[model samples]
Target: MFDLVYNTIFFASYSNFYGLGNITLGLFDVILAYIVTIIVSILVALVLKVPLLPSKPYRYSFDVSAIYPTPIIAIGILSIFLVLNYTFMYNGIVLAVVIGILSALFVKYLFDFVFPKPLDADEGEDM
Candidate 1:
């Protein structure tokens, strides 16, 4: 009974599984890619002089941080590439680094243009 269960679970083979052609990425590669993503993002953020944390105490702050959105954005982009079967031959690592740098640059330069601050309603009002 145990042998049957083992065979069914681990050894049973299908002709075509998910149409992905039995793509089983090594654990080491996946981990390396993630580490690369994190390291590159933090480095780029530091080079750009982005803060390590948000400036405002409130939620939805406009400030970019070395530890927050940069890594998140990097990982998100990496995930998309991984799902599309682009992670091969250490390509994932390279992609991660590129994404990290791009994200940091975007935060430094384009974030404000893309997400402008709200105008104050009481501005230029005379008391």
Candidate 2:
């Protein structure tokens, strides 16, 4: 029934990476890794005194905040590691946390140098 079809299609595709008897982490491990990433990101941002939200209006703000870039960057990096089959073992969780903290630091410090704002075209103009 459904198991037969699923095994045929899903395993066929998955076998390329996982192989016939490869050990893999469960869903809980994946979820826990993501949770670690998120929590570490926010905590690091708060410790560094990143604000709770963007300073300028949401539409035109590049500021990093406790609730914004921290979690987003953490999740993004975690997703990449997950796709590469890395999980929450052998200090993988610590690595994710470090990455999350580093990303927040980069956003706070080096982002402007890496992605500077464009000059205003109407500067020094009269109304």
Best by lDDT: 1
Report the alpha-carbon TM-score of model 2 versus the true structure. 0.68
Model 1 clash tally? 0
lDDT value for model 1: 0.71
Candidate 2 lDDT by residue in tens digits, 1-127: 4343233334333544645345554555556666877888888888888898888778887766889877887777766665555544542577677778887787678767987766666785446
**Candidate 2, position 70, lDDT:** 74
**Deviation (Å) of 70 in candidate 2:** 1.9
lDDT of each: 0.71, 0.67
Q: Can you list the residue pairs that collide in candidate 1? A: none
lDDT of 2: 0.67
The deviation in Å at residue 22 for candidate 1 is: 7.0
Residue-wise lDDT of candidate 1 within 1-127, one digit each (tens)? 4343223223212222457456545555666787898899899999999988998773856576888778988877876666555655564677878888998898788877987766556685446
| Span of 10 residues, lowest total lDDT, candidate 2 | 4-13
Error of 2 at 33 (Å): 1.1
